[model samples]
Structures are given as C-alpha cells and as structure tokens.
Target: MIGAAWRRTLNDDRSYHAINLNEFSFTVPIYAYQVEGEGGLSLIWSRPNRD
Candidate 1:
C-alpha cells in the first residue's frame, strides 16, 4: 500500500509515510506516488536469507 492507501486517510489528500519492518531487519525509504507510479509500490531495500 502507498500514498495514503490511495483511499484518503484523515480527509487529507497528502500525507507522509514510512515503512519499518523487523524480521530480517527490512526497511524501506520514504517514497511518493510519483515514484510508485502504476505499480503502486517501490522496493527501496530488501534482504533475504536463501540459506
């Protein structure tokens, strides 16, 4: 999900969001709709343990 869920939250057209997930210490940098484009999501950073 991106850009305020594209549904409108708190009646605000624009809002700031951050993604922080800790399992593999995964985190994503701030991204806007302009970057997401049609995909609606951008992978800024990722870590995977294939082993």
Candidate 2:
C-alpha cells in the first residue's frame, strides 16, 4: 500500500488551509531484490514474506 498527501488551501471565506490525501489506495510491490546474471544486473520483485 502507498499513500500520497498534500496541503491545500480553500478559496472560500477566510481561505482555510487543510491537509489532503488520496481517497483511494494503490497496490504496489513491497519486496525487491537485485541479481547478477548473464544479462548483467537485474531487478526482481515479489510479495512480502510473512516469515
């Protein structure tokens, strides 16, 4: 899971400032590894390990 946040200012009245974030979440790889092979350096990604 990943999150993004930003600060925003309202345009009404006294111009209130507020903190805002994404209402929806995105799924992304959490585990990654680098390997050296015949093709040179490579990157591999996998799911989180529970153990």
Candidate 3:
C-alpha cells in the first residue's frame, strides 16, 4: 500500500490540493491515470524482499 499528497499553485493566486492511495500485490504491474483538467500523478515501486 502507498499514499500520496499533491498541491498546485496557479499564476492567478489560486491553489489546489489532492490526496491519493494505491494498493497492489508484489507480483503485479501497477497502472495510473489522470483526467483532463485534473492534476498529475506519480507512481513509485520498491523492490521485493530477496530473502
């Protein structure tokens, strides 16, 4: 499981904030999507335990 937070500032003195959460198995591929006029998203994965 993973969590994230986001914030954006516009040139007109406007701002926006958002939050997201993600869950996936260690053996599966992850995917993400962003809608038009919405903010962006970032995905990060860590290597599984080797032991």
User: Which has the greatest TM-score?
Assistant: 3
Q: Model-by-model lDDT, in order?
A: 0.39, 0.40, 0.47
Top model number, lDDT:
3
Instruction: Give model 2's TM-score versus the native structure.
Output: 0.34
lDDT of 2 by residue, 2-51 (tens): 42323343454322222222223423334444445578766554554545
- Candidate 1 residue spans exceeding 4 A from truth: 1-16, 24-35, 46-51
Residue-by-residue lDDT tens digits, candidate 3, 1-51: 475656656687665544455556434333333323445544343444435
Q: Between 1 and 3, whose lDDT is larger?
A: 3
Greater TM-score among 1 and 2 belongs to: 2
lDDT of 1 by residue, 1-51 (tens): 332323323354553234434433334333333224366755454444545
Flag clash pairs in model 1: none
What TM-score does prediction 1 earn?
0.21
lDDT of 1 at 19: 43
